[model samples]
Target: MIYNEISKVIDNKEIAENIFEAHLSSDNLSKIAKPGQFINILPSSSFDKTMRRPMSLSYQDSNSFKIIYKPIGDGTRIMRSWKEGDSADIIGPLGNAWEVSKNKEAILLGGGVGIAPILNLYNNIESTHPSHLFFGARKKEEHFIDHNPDKNIYISTDDGSAGIKGNLFEAMKSIFDINDFKDKSIYVCGPPMMMEAVRKFSVEHDIECHLALETIMACGIGICQGCTVEKCSDESSTDTYRNKYELVCMDGPIYKANEVKTCLL
Candidate 1:
């Protein structure tokens, strides 16, 4: 179920270069927040920023949840000042979640701040399912590399500052043969270019792949119709959705790689 309420901050700290992780207390909300779902948070009660900021849920426990973000915008800039004991108006657990396959090994990819949701998925499924993570960033400092010692972790940076010093595909190719992905399900959350590349690679290999999209949202719910993306022409036209477009806030934040025309928009 969806919820709109005031949640208190439990902790907020800078985890990486410009990335900040905030823990919020929300018993019921946390209980239902899935790996790919997101929340819209009002950074402050003031009218300076009318629209709430949509953020992915990075982690969740029994009584609280976490959001990891970079304070690069006005709303998020205000969010940086928020401390423990502060209250935030939030609406969540929104959007569809990653449909993980129990039968196939999971290959996860995350780029930049998009790693938040991917990390959430990894935390939830790594214990029982075999999973691998390929994380990429522009520089060494921007990457979040801390993980369980036993977990399969791969790293890449555009500038060769860390790990493979290349893109995700480069990193993957170095350690994994094409056959290694034979029965694996790929899940990705990243910049449009990265997602598009992964989508093409997945299609070429005929592997099952899912993408968690990042787009500007006027409303976290489907009400505003502001987060629309062109649908693939081959997608079946439903009576209520025959317009050749899909609302990212409602229909997805998550979609099968082949289901959408392109993520480059």
Candidate 2:
């Protein structure tokens, strides 16, 4: 079920370089929210910004949920100024959750701020399952996860400042061959290029892959018809008047890699 509520801010602070983490109290939203689902939050109560900003859920418990984001524009910049006791008009638990495979090992890939959903997926699955995380960023300082010896985590940066010098694919290639991932399921959320590369690689190797897509959203619901992605199976569609496009906000943010075309924005 979807919810529209005025959630109260429990805590808000900058955790990394330009990245802010905020916790909002919402009992219903928190309980039903799943990995790869997101919330749409209005920066202010007034009509200065009509469109709400969509943010992926990074963590959640019984009474509150956490969102990690980078303030890249006016809406998010206003969100950065939000503090404790502030009320945010939000709609959420939108989009589908990741279809986690219980029998297979899991491989999670994330980049930059896209790590929000990936982290959420990991936190949900890592406890009882075997999971590996491959996280990438432009620079070493841009990464949110600190170096920890206990986690099955790998890091890569564009510059040679972090673990692997190249992209996430490079880091994955160094550790495992195609045969090593035969029994694994891959989940990815990141920039367009990164997701595209992973999609191609997954197809080439016949690996099972799922992607959490990111796009500009207006309504965060299907009413606006603003966030549509071309469906991969359009050739079989019977509807000729309308193109075979799915709304990202309602139908997905999570889709099987083979179910949609790659390089989704």
Candidate 3:
């Protein structure tokens, strides 16, 4: 576990109603983190919470890190109180990263808070492949397609506030469904039900699919098994153990799309 103090907090604003984007400088962890991994944040007071909260590594440079978050409690509220120079404790680049395969064109899908991990995935892999980013939210008011748009950036919303006015699976199909990508691969990160729907779509369309699994984690490292997800024998994740559980903290947070089993669907 690695620890550090905040060197700066550049922006603090409502990215959405309760959502915020906080840019902090942490030379310590940024140097070692990979694209699809995350960090565990510890509140200043141990009396507040028993464990650290997990947040994705949105973007980072040599001396800084940026995260987009929604205020959830005293912990997040306290994080908002941090100024330009303060201390923020962090642990890890914990989890299995997305392994770049032989595929060329890749579809990166995400929605709601699940979009965090893929933001950095895009930053790291966009240059290596032709990435089409499909994002969805409840309304156009919540749509954040980043600062740049391209043939790759597509958006949709549930309330018709923005792009396609539907969910991300629909947003993706609207552009080019499974048949469109031919042999293209897909990477997904989102609510479990949403991922399940995307997984079905990818399978029906004959596209390869991978998922970034996000679950409640008391310990962002392997100890707690709070983030464990199951694997199964399938065409998509052929190497997955049929009846075994994989710890999302150590083995994943990002998993092959077919390996997961969801309680919702």
Question: Who wins the TM-score comparison?
Answer: 2
**Tens-digit lDDT track of model 3 for 89-204:** 77666777776666667788878877777778888888778888887788867766742355678777888877776888877877784457786788888777788888777666
- Model 2 score (lDDT): 0.86
lDDT of 1: 0.86
The TM-score of predicted model 3 comes to 0.87
Greater-lDDT candidate between 1 and 3: 1
TM-score of each: 0.93, 0.95, 0.87
Which candidate would rank higher by TM-score, 2 or 3? 2
lDDT of 1 by residue, 1-265 (tens): 8888799988988887998889989968889888999998998788476688999998999889988889988988877889989999999888999999999999888888888899999999989999998888888888768533256888888998887778776776676788888889999998898889888888888889999988888976778888887777653656355467889998889999878888887
> lDDT (CA) for every model shown?
0.86, 0.86, 0.73
lDDT, residue 61, candidate 1: 93
Candidate 3 residue pairs in clash (backbone atoms < 3 Å): 213-253
lDDT of 2 by residue, 144-251 (tens): 776442577988889969777888777777778889989998999888888888888888888999989998889887898888887677686686523577788989
- Score candidate 2 by TM-score against the native: 0.95
Off by over 4 Å in 3: 1-8, 146-150, 233-243, 263-265
